[model samples]
Target: MSSKEKLNDAFSTISDSFLTECARPLKKTVFQKRICRLLPLVAVLVSIAILLPIAVFRHKSDLIPGRWTLISHADETVRKEMLVESAHKPTVSMSMNYNKLPAEQAEAVGFSPEKDPCVELFAQWFYSQITYDYRMHFSLFQKEAVDYSFTSEAIERGFTFESALDKLDTVTSHFYNGIKYDLFYSLVSCKDLTAELENTQGQFYKSIVRCGADPAKISMIVEYTFDDIKLIMNERFLNTSPDGERFNFMFYCYDGHWYIFETEMENDFSIDVLGKDEDWLSILIVPQECYGRVVAVGRGYLLLDNGEYFMTLDELDLKVGDYVHVSFTGFQTKGRFIADDGSTEQKVTCNNLLTVKLAEPSTPSEEERSNE
Candidate 1:
């Protein structure tokens, strides 16, 4: 074959597109090289942008267990306006369907959880405590007191007031958001209770909770059970204040009466200058175990032969004569009672009883021996 005949054969084998300059490899620019290198990163960013919100939207609700409707303030934001606070704060509300609750618990919560008498009582208790409106729930329970020292401290904190009422805006805003939610878990949470109870209860007794008079028991009129109590407040109410970020006022049912048994409050600064995180919470004390003889048992009170009195939440079929071993969250609050003779007695309230076991019989106390 001649050279011309061989070239014609090769050209016939190759396509016309490949034979053109358009199919030839060209030198890439620096910008094109950078873009090529960034392709994978750009793809990853696009994926994240599309997926992150969907993941959030599909996230489950973590509100308290059970079906509940707000009966008090209609909405959290509306509730804030009613408080003594002066600042305009927008509250974020969460609606929940309580899952994993025991059947009995679900029934106890009822169709309208807010209708629980304790919830109403708690609402009144919180309002009176927050507004210092003793006139609100007159005769229902003993009124909550403010430390007069707060007045002097407010000045020390560089706050001034025309009247006592005028001071709450700055004072409350710095210390609290004036919003709260209630939850009832049959088993008490010892985690936060034991940690803060001692210091705050001590301060409370020193300044306020010391009482010689029996607190008037307010009847709910409705047969609502007051157990498994939690009042989740907006964060950063000072950890030690009487009306703090959580469980502003807690009550226990004893002798068919609702009595204020525990309280946690915000720090005095009413200012975030304390350098705590936005979601900062109270410290938790280590739990403990105790073995004792049940000298007395009532609806809300548990007393041991050893003179320890506990306001406990337990599912045990406890009787007055039983000897048992108990695992509990540590003590935090002490109810101080004054006697007519001017002597003072203190009683510590312990809760979050994780477990109770019937232990081998221990020796009887001298008091128990005498009572027998």
Candidate 2:
């Protein structure tokens, strides 16, 4: 009935209540403890589920939906040596006049300066036209007249050899390591240019103007840098001197991110444009469904329609004079094509071939042949 008696009673009651709560179900207590232990893992899984798509999208930034390969000359010294071997090979002479065509051919083709804008542009503005006669045995296609002329305006505007070198100095001044400038240079630089060459007689000299970009095909994206920089080069533009040498306006986008495309020395000493060591990489834009007919088949490459050709890795079971349709789904170059020049460091050229099929050749009837 005193204060001590009350305090003792209250302590006993509190101790009993605490023990009773601790003696509750052990299974429920263990389950709650397990959930608490897994909380960090659950949070991590939830975060990954929400961010996986964002990570994938970031990885694929600046990737265009097509395929292309990176090419670089490992050794310029080897290239120069190969050039020496190519020049002494046998060569034949051929000529073409853009201003005037043969009477019979002119009647059928009708590419007069009055009717055709291209013809008129070349004839009225351009001064000289030259032809490139191949001296090699490997013919991807029949030798067509490789000729071009430049307009006076394009010549005046195009880059000269000396001026192009000067522009190269100015452009490279802004370059530093890891700072990408392919797209920036392409946007600001002048792509077309002119160069001088000696005549065939080795007596006189001439200047070549520019052909400009082809309206049919705008430009080809060749180099895609690691920083997602794309270097676009316009379709092949060409000029020629009185001698049988070619001057090409090529965008040197790989090593030198300069604007003034340089002139390449294309002559008997030069490798055939289709042979092995051409810089520009072409995309198979139009499939056979668009327009392709096989005319001839060779070891590694096939001839389509007339001049078009595609190389394959494995030898196709195709034959010459077979009419067929070709289709390409994608582009891929796996292995390297080793040149016979005996270089230890071979070139890494891709075998990006189109998946093609062959069909039975259609035979023309006697009447059809006679009509032809």
Candidate 3:
């Protein structure tokens, strides 16, 4: 028999219903076919969904132009007051495309690696600061770099600023409000620089890396003058490290701009870095006396209404409610002054009480008196 006849004889033994069922076409079910056809379309839709936001964000911050890039979108509100205008007219001409460049004073004065754009940034943006009428230092802090924020990790570890951009209020608190740094020396020099770059791998590296800015900006810079060493600390300590050097500060680049962030030299109200009234007392930053009104008094100490707690000198015999002229140095001989009542508060001594008045008190008008 032929192979076709053999197949027909075999099929004839099966039921007609089986034969009929076998004659049906072998094809996918409607539900299966619909799912298969929809998968490619769903995949295309999913791809669009994933890429849409990224495309939008990239479209916004596509480029960081130069120093101090603004992070706001076109629709975002504009900043005011604290906003620093971006300008880069290099004193030592260099390419605008580079990350770092040498500055005038930093190079001419031979600062080694300190001759960076940061120094130039300082020279132009904040020349009045280091050589400031330091008396007004606190009030000037509102002026800033591109963007600013604190690092929680650095603070939690008891390390104040590990090259992170921060506010200078704590450091500024140490300054005799309204004192200028130029009082000690007419000729100021670019003392030192510590430009610490943040690691690209760091969790806190909020850099404009895409725009070619480094993950780390700049960290610390100190300005010092040896003028007051002998007078401030006496001969013995005059041979020491700071030698009554004026200010130690922190700096960093944020949002593509530079900032003279904080003074690392001292924290008068807290546990201080430079302690000892004699160290910074006579080197007064304030042109006038700091006035303190006695709210509370204790043995060898007096508490002022402004929360100033200071140990009194043997010569300063002051009483409560007396509007005494006072000054504060960031330095303290002791971290905390223990009171007879077993209490303690940070204080600058009565020597700053303007014990020997420099000028006779002048009577003020009603407006000045009321304002005071």
Candidate 4:
């Protein structure tokens, strides 16, 4: 299918999943499709805003009979405030016409195959929030990108910056039906671009973010800058080899758009690609007072430190002493099931498929192997 079609399909999936998930008891409030009902009011306001500009220009047509200047000089007295306003709301005044562009064109812009896998993933994840469902859907992941548009509106409504920040905290706990990737964003630089665009020039903000699937580990750092909606990502990949070296990835792009059409990430560690190139591992840490039957391999729950257990989605050939690695897709909480004897058990369900070697046996040490 076409790129736009694919993007629509991906959003359709997210929308459908949102509906399906929202119907569930506790999932309803997490991310409801409430925007549909509110969109009419927004549309009316936008229509009026658009019309007001046209009406003003039409009345002033006599004054500007020939040509209009695209860029105007900033008054020195207000230049600092103007710069702040420009940086605060950087999205180009003109809406990007991605629909008219070919799918390849959209893919070519800004996106590169050689880019750092982590950077691409971050870009996609960050862009996904901006595109599908607006900033509200950002709660699905560890909050990273700041919605200046929303912030601007909030400030205009007379809220203090600190209050606005607190008000934007929508996600109370990280529990949602979406990809389980965590992103921690740190603002690196916000400055005026020295090398300007032909028709457009404004302040650009650079953010250095540590993003990856594993909440415990920072896999890679992505340096990305955005001037309005145009995003450029400097991708870097973390080599899983013994050296743990990192390398710059150069993905060819068209006009430097770099936005991913779909949310399916290339570096999402949870999506298991079956082969020797696997980067995920699973191990069974047997509890000291464990007294359970070997009914199934990975068909069990992992006991959390807080006296809670996380159940496995698929069965693993996990023996007590086995240190097996497995790709973890996601999980479901309060996931309950009825046993054969009619007993219901509630637990955190893990979602993953057994791909590589079934429970690799704990091998003897190198010294032991040499002696043998």
TM-score of each: 0.26, 0.20, 0.23, 0.19
Residue 163 lDDT in model 1? Answer: 39
Compute the lDDT for candidate 4: 0.26
Clashes of 2: 4
Q: Kindly indicate the candidate among 1 and 3 with the higher TM-score.
A: 1
Q: Report the lDDT tens digits of candidate 4 across residue range 78-187.
A: 00000000112111111111122234532533333233332333343443332222232333233232223233444566665456444333221111112111111211
Q: lDDT tens digits, residues 34-101, model 3? A: 10011111111111100111122232233333233223335452211111212221011111111122
Candidate 1 local Cα displacement, residue 37, angstroms: 55
Candidates ranked, most accurate by lDDT first: 1, 3, 4, 2
Off by over 4 Å in 3: 1-105, 108-198, 201-250, 253-257, 262-350, 354-372
Please write out the lDDT profile of model 2 over residues 120-214, one tens digit for every residue: 21111111111122211112111111122211222344654344334333432221111110110011111111121222221111111233332
| Winner on lDDT (1 vs 4) | 1
- lDDT of all predictions: 0.35, 0.26, 0.31, 0.26
Best by lDDT: 1
- The best candidate by TM-score is 1
For candidate 4, the per-residue lDDT at 154 reads: 47
**lDDT at position 342, candidate 1:** 29
Question: What is the lDDT for 26 in model 1?
Answer: 70
